[model samples]
Target: MMGHAHALSGIVGWMAVVPLLDGHEFFGLRFDLGPGEIVAGSLVCAGAALIPDLDAKSSTITQTYGVVTRGLSAAFNWIFGGHRNGTHSLLFALLMGGLTQALALWSELAVQIFVFLLLGIAFNGLGLGNDKNRLASEVINAMGTAAVTLALYASGVNYAWIGVAVAFGCLLHFAGDMATELGVPLLWPASKYRFGRNIGFTTDGKVERNIVTPGLTIAILLLSFYLFPWPELLPQA
Candidate 1:
């Protein structure tokens, strides 16, 4: 699947699961998902959804931070055995979640900085800026990312569940790819089988561009209204 589609899947997947998680404990972490947490998790998930593709040099996530991400992509490609191999596996999700959770546990500032970076990636994936102008796009993406991060910080958003969200996002990405013709190898190394291969629509084809993408966009809108307390958020008349 394409970058935007993966990003959209991340958001929709997170929001779809938010109600089940809002007041529950899962995997030793208690979730108290408020508005800020919802938004933060969605963006973080969106960013993470692009992570499996980091092994692909031309992936949106790889191009997100230029030299930094490019270098990371090269390393991941070498370590994971190229695009759609180990990085697309379940093991990759666990490692990413573990690393992100460790970062959160280690330093609040580091987590915040990481969130800022992920938000920037999410914005780029969602095509928030005019890509025709590369410099302008980067500047705009940076500004937008900063604003959202600051707002979430001011709202006292707690990111205790960030690791879970990241892991879930990567899983969602795998699901998206599984829906495409070139399916993901969810159990790489253990088995070289590519699950769901040639069993779905073509990537970025009619199904994705027309049906999937639009459907995801509409879902986000509907979920926004359903998940958020509009009356509480609105200014008093």
Candidate 2:
């Protein structure tokens, strides 16, 4: 389900408001990240959003996350006993967060970049970003990622080094999911990991459910830009 909507969720991660809940700020100050920033942030965001799907048996994202998904599925069935049980826990989340933050620190990235990259990928796992995307639509997602990444660059973020760091954030996410069968590679090295072969769930009600949230999310993401009265909130950056 990769498409314009997936791009938007990744873009939203650029807002960098999560850590603010704990009263911390990135870049030594708190300022609104304009759509440009959001666009740049979406690069890693898009990768992370879909990171959890790596467990699917034939998924391309899974294959791209690390090693080819074909051989790894066997190892997964043996470990953790199942997919949803092991890989999606808070333990892995912390590992991912720490790894991304470490990369950012190693690369001297701003805290904002580290957090948003994690946000973008996680949101996709919640079943929101790519209801419209498929294997062939990767560049569509990449463009979405680049839009946010470049926006940060244009805003004087010096993303030249941070870009590699962001990719590592994506790598951490993909690798974490590799511990499960539903993993994805996120389009790197043409390979990825997985933890399961199937959840035994049917597609019977998926269409109806997907039409609700994914569709609504798309509407909001778009209206926030093209339709919503944005200037009233903060001045359209």
Candidate 3:
């Protein structure tokens, strides 16, 4: 699937679960997902949704941070057995979730830096800037990412569930890929089988561009209405 499709699925997926997760406790973690958390999780998930594609040098994720991401891309490609291999598996999700959770537990500064990086990836995946103009787009994306990260920081958004969000986002990416012709290898090393292969529409093709992307966009809008307190947030005329 395309980058935007994966990113959009992440946003929609997180928003879809906000209601069920809010004010609930699961596995000893409290999910008090207020407005700030909802927004932060959405973006974090969106960023993570693009992670599996990091093995591909030309992927949106690899291009997001230039040298830093390019180096990571090279490393992931080697460590994970190339694109769509180990990184697309459940194991990868678990590992990433564990590491992110550990980081969150270890140091506040580290987690903040991680969030900033993820938000940058999210903005890039969401197609926030002009593709034709590279320089302008990077500037816009950087400024937007910084502004949003700072805003969420100022809002005191607790990231206790960031690990779950990251793992779930990867699953969402797998789901999106499964909907494409070349499915992801969810089982990975254990079984080199591609689930949903040859059964779905082509990636970035007509169905995806016209139906899937638009559908996701609409879903985001609808979910936003259902999840947020619009009446309270908006000013009365």
Query: What tens-digit string does per-residue lDDT give for candidate 1 at 1-237?
Result: 899999999999999999999999977899999999999999999999999999998999999999999999999999999889999999999999999999999999999999999989988999999479989988999999999999999999999999999999999999999989776778887988898888888888999999999999999999999999999999999
Candidate 3 residue lDDT tens string, 1-237: 899999999999999999999999999999999889999999999999999999999999999999999999999999999988999999999999999999999998898999999999999999998489999999999999999999999999999999999999999998888889777789888999899888899998999999999999999999988888998889998
Candidate No. with top TM-score: 1
How far does residue 195 in candidate 2 sit from its true spot (Å)? 18
* Number of backbone collisions per candidate: 0, 41, 0
Prediction 1 TM-score vs. true = 0.98
Lowest lDDT sum, 10 consecutive residues, model 3, at 175-184
The order by descending TM-score is 1, 3, 2
Q: Which pairs clash in model 3?
A: none
What are the models' TM-scores? 0.98, 0.47, 0.97
lDDT of 1: 0.94
Off-target runs (Cα >4 Å) in candidate 2 are 1-32, 65-82, 108-151, 158-210, 226-237
Sequence-dependent TM-score of model 3: 0.97
Please list the residue runs of candidate 1 whose C-alpha ends up more than 4 Å from where it truly belongs after superposition.
none
TM-score, prediction 2: 0.47
